[model samples]
Structure formats: structure tokens, C-alpha cells
Target: MTTIEAPRSRPTRRRGVNWEKWGWLYMRFSGILLVVLIFGHLLVNLFLGDGVSAIDFAFVAGKLADPFWIVWDTLLLWLALIHGANGMRTLTNDYARGKLRVVLLVLLAGATVVLLVLGTLVLTTFDPCIGDSTVDALIEACAAQ
Candidate 1:
């Protein structure tokens, strides 16, 4: 029987920013921030004032009217979505194979970016007086100023 020979392998050291390490750091950082933001959100929206009974269309309109809440929510959206997407990327890498792995990663990244853009636009450009049904309410609220 002929002897089998192992294939030769080459070793090359990588340099510069360790993105995976940064990604890991980001996950931990974002996770901590998410806990604060999420809990604060739940506390304010679900437990404060009139509680769940106070949550209505007008309540949302009123909150979004303020710039502070808008910024808070925007950050929350960005951090949570990125954290979740990255976590899912880790999972996909663990389970997927070859071309399928690359495809999944691309799709995940694309979806995350699209969602972030859309969500940010919605938050920043939100016009409470857009539709007819709630236009009156928003107008009245604005006019009250």
C-alpha cells in the first residue's frame, strides 16, 4: 500500500484591529445598556402614571412629540437590534456551512442595516399629524402651544 502524505499548510499572522474582539466587547457593552434601557422603558411605559390603561394612541403621540424620548428610543432601537443581529450572526456561523454560511451572514447584515435605517428614519421624521384619523388630535396638541 502506498503511504499517504499530509498536505502542507501555510501560517500567516494577522495584524491591525481585532474586529471579533471588538464585536465581543460591543456585545457585552450593548447588553448592559440594553438592560437599563429596556427596564426603564418598561417601567415608564407600563408601570408609571396610569399604567397600562394610560397607553393609547394619544399617549404615544405625546411621548414622541418630545425630543428626549425620541433620542432614548432611537438609541434603544439601534443597540438592541445590533446586539440581536450580532448574536444571531454568531449562531449562524456556528451552524451554517460553506456558501450557505456566507449567504446567511450577508442577509443578516443587510437586514440589520435596513432595519436600522428604517427605524431611525421613522423615529426622526415621525409626523404625528400624518393621517386623517389622528390628525385632529395631533393638531389640537400642537395648537395648544
Candidate 2:
């Protein structure tokens, strides 16, 4: 029986920046923040005041009208989308192979970008009074503005 030879290895060297380490840290921190944001969102929308029944267009308009909620929603959108895209990239790297892996990663990036742009636009440019509606309350509110 011949003896097995040990595989040769290159010496490890320090690099400029370790992005993977930072990504791992980001995942942990963002997950914690997402939990809090999600819970607070649910609490306010589904459990407060008139509960889920109060979740009409007016409700959304009211929430988005506040600068605090605008910033909160923007943070939620960016963090969650980036976190999800990074996770998918990791998964693709782990399980995918050949050109399919590249395709998947590209698709993931495109989708994430598109969603982030759309979500941010919606959050920032939301006008509750853009359309004519039969709702007197909304009409009056818009007229008052």
C-alpha cells in the first residue's frame, strides 16, 4: 500500500478588506433590526385602534404623511431588500454551478434593485390625494391640504 501524500497549500495572506466578514456582521445586525421593525409595524397596523379594519387607503396615507414613518419605511425597505439579495447571493454561491450560478446571481441583483427602486419611489412620492374618489373624508382632507 502506497502512503497518501498531503495536499500542498498556499500560505494565507492578509488582504485589503474582508467584505465577507462585514456581510456576516450586517446579516446579524439587520436581522435584529428587521424583527423590531416588523413587530412594530404589525403592532401599529393590526393591533392598534380599529385594528386591521382600519387599514384603508386613508390609513396608509396617514402613516406615510409622517416624516418618521417615511424614514422608517425607507430603512425597512433598503435593509430588508439588501439583506435578502445578499442571502440569495450566498445561497447561489453555495449550491449553484457553472453559468447557471451567474445567471441566478444576476437575476437576483436585478430583481432586488428593481424592487428597491420601486419601493423607495412609492414610499417617498406617495400622494393620497392624486385621484378623485367618492370618499368624502379623503376628498375633504385633500381639499384642506
Candidate 3:
């Protein structure tokens, strides 16, 4: 039987950034950060206070109103999407060939960018005070603004 060879590092462009290395590093670092952010989010939203029953539009509105939560959510959105996209790209590279790989990579990148833009817009521009909601929670939240 032939011995399997180890993976080799590809040659890089002179004076250019080694993006593959950076991507690998990002995967590791972002994974650790995501665990913390995700767990914290779950604990606050699902376990504390009234638990799962407490989640609703009003609860979401309240969280989004705070700048801290807005930033927290933005980070979660960007990091998670990019991390997932990067992994997909890596998988596409490893498993796909020729035109299919190119097509998949392009599609993956386009989708990731679109989602990131939309998610960020929603998070940053969300107005809980909009619309006519009779819920006391929403009404009270709007009134305080």
C-alpha cells in the first residue's frame, strides 16, 4: 500500500497577505468567542427570569432597544455568518472540482454578504416604536422613548 502524503502549504504571492492562514486563525478564534456569546445569549433569554415563556416581540424589542444588546447581536450576526461561510468555502474547495467549485464559492460569498448586510441593517435600524401594537409592553416601550 502507498503511504498517504501530508498536506502542503501552497505558495503565496510576494508581499501579499496570506489569507488562508488568516482564515484558519479566524475559524479557531471566532469559534471560541461564538461559544461564549451563544451561551450567554441562551442563558439570558431561555433560562433566566421567566425563561422561554418570556420571549416574545416585546422581549425582543426590549433587548434591541439597548445599545449593548445591539452591539452584541451585531457581533454575533457577523461572526457567525462569516464563520459558516468560510467553512462552506473550505468544504467546497476540498470536495468540488473545476467550474462547480467556482460557482459554489461565488454563490456562497454572495449569500453571506447579502445576509450580513440584511442582518446588520435590521439590528441597527430596528424601531420598536413603529406600528400600532396594543400590547402593553410595546406601548410602554414606545412611550418611554
Candidate 4:
């Protein structure tokens, strides 16, 4: 009779930090938050008051002028961008190979950072009455100030 042997398994090592675990948690939490934020945003922009027609420059300016809206917008922007970028990173890891994967990840990170910074700046420093004398509404709004 021939002797039978069992395959040996490699030993597993415990790491100090579990980044993948944290990333998985982040995806779950961020997805939940994004759903609420996005729905609230759409409801406010498309269902409240005058609806879509009310969504013009002054409307945006008015919203951004409020501290509450500013914070809300910033949170939405950061969360959405990071969530999207992380998702893309996961996809890249799964399908991309070698240098191309690295390049795509680096570019993704760079773009996310740039967009977050620019978006935050626009939200925080927006002036409804900047250099525009054509719009009577803006002129009136600025004149009141």
C-alpha cells in the first residue's frame, strides 16, 4: 500500500496594524453617510421651494454663505471624494498590474487632493457679489451689505 501525506499549511503572522480591516470599515461607514448626505442634497436642491429653477449662482452663494451649509458641503465633498478614490484604488488593485496600478493610484490620490482643496476653497471663500454688476440680484444682495 502507498503511504498518504497531508499538505502542510504556511504559518500566519500577526501584524501590528490591520489596514485592510480599517479600510473595509471605512467603506461601510462612508457609504452610509454618503447615502444620507446625497439624498438630503438632492431633496434640498430639487424639491424644496422653487425647485430646480431656484438653483442659480445666487442660490449657491446664499447656501455657501451660511456656516451650517458650508460645513455640510465640506463634509459631503470630502467624504464623497475619499469614498470614490478608495473605491477606485480597490478596483485598480484588483485589475491593474505592476507600474500601471501604481501610476493609477498615485494619479487618483493627486486628483482627489486637488479637487478637495479646490472645492473647499470655493465653498468657504465664495462671494456672491464678486466683480459682477450685471446681475441686479447680486448687486442688491451686495448693496444690502
Task: For candidate 3, write residues 1-145 as lDDT tens digits.
Answer: 5565567856435787888889999999999999988898999999999999999888898899799999999999988999999999989989999999999999999999999999999998998888887688778867987
lDDT of 4 at 21: 80
* Candidate numbers sorted by lDDT from highest down: 3, 2, 1, 4
- Across 22-48, the per-residue lDDT of candidate 1 in tens digits comes to 999999999999999999999989999
Residues 1-145, model 4: lDDT tens digits: 5555566755455778888788889889999998999899999999999899889777887787788888888889998999898899999999999899999999999999999999999887877778766668779878999
Q: Rank order by TM-score, top first?
A: 2, 4, 3, 1
Among all windows of ten consecutive residues in candidate 2, which has the lowest summed lDDT? Answer: 2-11
lDDT of 2 by residue, 36-128 (tens): 988888899999898999998878888998999999999999988999899999999999999999999999989999999999999988898
Global Cα lDDT for candidate 4: 0.87
Candidate 4: how large is its RMSD? 5.7
**What TM-score goes with each of the models?**
0.80, 0.84, 0.83, 0.83
Clash number for model 4? 0
TM-score of 1: 0.80
- Candidate number with the higher TM-score (1 or 4): 4
